[model samples]
Target: TEIFDGFSKTVSKCKFIPVVCGSSLENGGISNLLEIIAKSFPSYISKKHFKAISKQDNKEMQIEISENGNFCGFCFKTVLDQFNGKLSFIRVLNGEIKKDDEVLIVEKNNKFKVTKILQPFGNKIEEMEKGVTGDIIVLQKLDDISTTYTIGSKDISYTYAFDKLPQPVYSVAISAKDKNTEDKLISTLHKFSEEDPTLIVKYDPETKQNVISGMGELHLEVYFSKIRKQLKLEFETSIPRINYKETITKQVESRYKHKKQSGGHGQYGEVAIRVSPNKRGEGFKFVNSIVGGVIPKQYIPGVEKGLIEGLNNGVLGKFPIIDIIVELFDGSYHEVDSSEMSFKIAARQALKDAMTKGDPILLEPIMNLSVYAMDKYTGDIISDLNGKRGKILGMDPIPGGLTLIKAEVPHSELLRYATDLKSITQGTASFELEFSHYSPITGKLAEQVIEERKKFITAEEEE
Candidate 1:
């Protein structure tokens, strides 16, 4: 057979043919033909006459034509069915699978039953009872199964971990249009994220909004469209807010007292705390430096807890506080009136007082940005980046007249950078951004941010 002769020579040479079969008298397809050659005629691709495709001539590549063995499947995508919750699309790499068979989730280290199996033909599905190696099948109601999970047996301890997708480069704040659908929106978002590894959904406590991020704006748009079609939920999305940090610069001492007198009992607690700035990114630190029972040991945790709550929002712009150390030196407490609640209040007030007097400042998140553009647009791209308060780090030239530009830019200035770059380069330039470090923002920009936050809060109150 001329087909057998051509396939044997191609495998021996290890050459990648663009189209293996065109107009032919073949039975099944190219895959079935390869299987026949591998199993029935393994000698056709003997090592003696083989050429390595990856330049690893010394390495032995096992070509197994598995017919009916242990169940080994790799899940790549998931589809939502009307009757069943989720149907995982899996390609059986080795072994045969049947309905009601139990398989081990390799990565999760859990066992799940294959409830109902189906074969996908285009957009339609037909009930399937058994599937062999190299056949694509679907299993119903595997809720916990996600993309790239290996479904196999415990006896055969082999798992395949696919390469992870790239991190999301764009984000937008999302909220359900109807308050009643908010819970359902979040649940559906999580389910969509399981199917698409590039989709990321997280809650931003700073702005009190749900954020959906992906590789680009279009990626998120597609997800939102699918959600609307499948779950019949509408969402409102806007630019995500920047999460700024607040920190102190100088050491300061603060003393606060909580005194309340009621008919039954009185509350009295006093605390003295020394606040100092720590190293950048060191976060918060609480130290108890009491001696001679000035402040009782039992109530010390109350002080720390109060201080932690205070750290959630700083005096400047109410942002999260970071890189600060608080030392509890000395304080006076009443034997009968002092309690954890009183101490907590006193500690909270003391920390806030210290921060206000300690020269608090606002810090904005910086992003490490890398832009790839053709040489013709490098100058324009760099100029546009500079306008966004970006600091150029370095530049490198590569083949095809492409230049790579690396820089650091503030996250606030990049909310719409993806769209702007596409417009500037006419869809020829691309860039990726990642969180770097927090840097201080001063003068007009800081004042503007505070003003905007106040307006946002006021609008929420009105609503």
Candidate 2:
């Protein structure tokens, strides 16, 4: 099993090994993966055991392997199978608890009891006591228990949390296959996400996707692959799309009047509003300027609610609209029929109409990327970063001709940068990424994205 090459002995090198096995229809690969883990994975004795830091003190607590060591287990990940209900998994670090043995799940200085314990195979069932150090066991029907919880003796008051994982750099629009299955899909996804700290789920109102995003594309691939067998749901997915936001470039004022003549009561609501773009990332703000009760103070919230809702669903091809302010400087509200509903509709209509005249802009996310590469390729690395619209922040030399480079670049430019990095650096480069502030998009790029979204909608509508 020893495979070595010139790359291994290279002075400047970045390395990673993926332990993987899988089969499309038949699932022997998972079994082989289990076997490999059993044979090669470090046990509690071999692993550097950790205890979460005490709440009262910043000091981290360590777990001792000796008999005197406290009974502690880390509930690192959780899985909620639709049929199986809930699976709260923990790795025993010191003392062990047997099946039917109750344990407390500690998190944020709060503790909850495990309802029952189950041994996991392809599926779950009752098992012998999980009484051993380093053994993994799962608990079921736990309501308050969650990931990163410590399970041990109550007297052992505290443990340290693990390092915070990197924030998710990429996102996609996701939703259940069907509206009827939305709740199940969400519950399943949340429980599945409990196990993997890296994956993040976000609801993007612009694209209207219940996006399940992870470190990279491959991370989410495993999640969707198991959705059916475990979660017991067949889901439909929207095409993955980047989250884009919309903002205004100029300020404008306008009025909207919703004068409706219905059978019983006529709805008449008038609003005079001014719209302006705020600083980036500030979100939305509403200023009530209607003085002397020209527009009743009570209806101010109605206009505010409408504007807030509009911000969520952008004016441009359903992107998230952000960084804007609206002021209700003057307006007239009907005492009889003018209510929050009428004012809300009027305000939304006013905003859309005003935005059409006011200059608007599309904004895209920028990413802060850091790369570690061999010193030999420093020159080449700098060139590549510039090509991706990246500005180098700093570079520091590491053990190898190995250099760490910090840069800020547009997220769109680096969508495929990970693969390119490996190829350019002979598979010896590793990089980290974070979301930087966004800037305005040029007319050409914004037009392109808008056209692409419209084309997709048109094609789907045709089908």
RMSD over all Cα atoms, model 2: 7.3
Model 2 C-alpha lDDT per residue in residues 52-125, reported as the tens digit of each score: 68756767767557434667877777876668776777777777676545455556445554445566665546
**RMSD each, Å:** 6.2, 7.3
- Write candidate 1's Cα lDDT for 273-328 as tens digits: 99999998788999999999989998899999999999988887788899999999
Where model 2 places Cα greater than 4 Å from the true spot, the runs are 1-51, 54-71, 77-89, 93-102, 108-147, 152-159, 166-196, 199-203, 210-239, 457-463
TM-score of each: 0.82, 0.72
Number of colliding residue pairs in each model: 0, 12
**What local lDDT does model 1 show for residue 149?**
80
- What is the Cα-based lDDT of residue 126 in candidate 2? 60
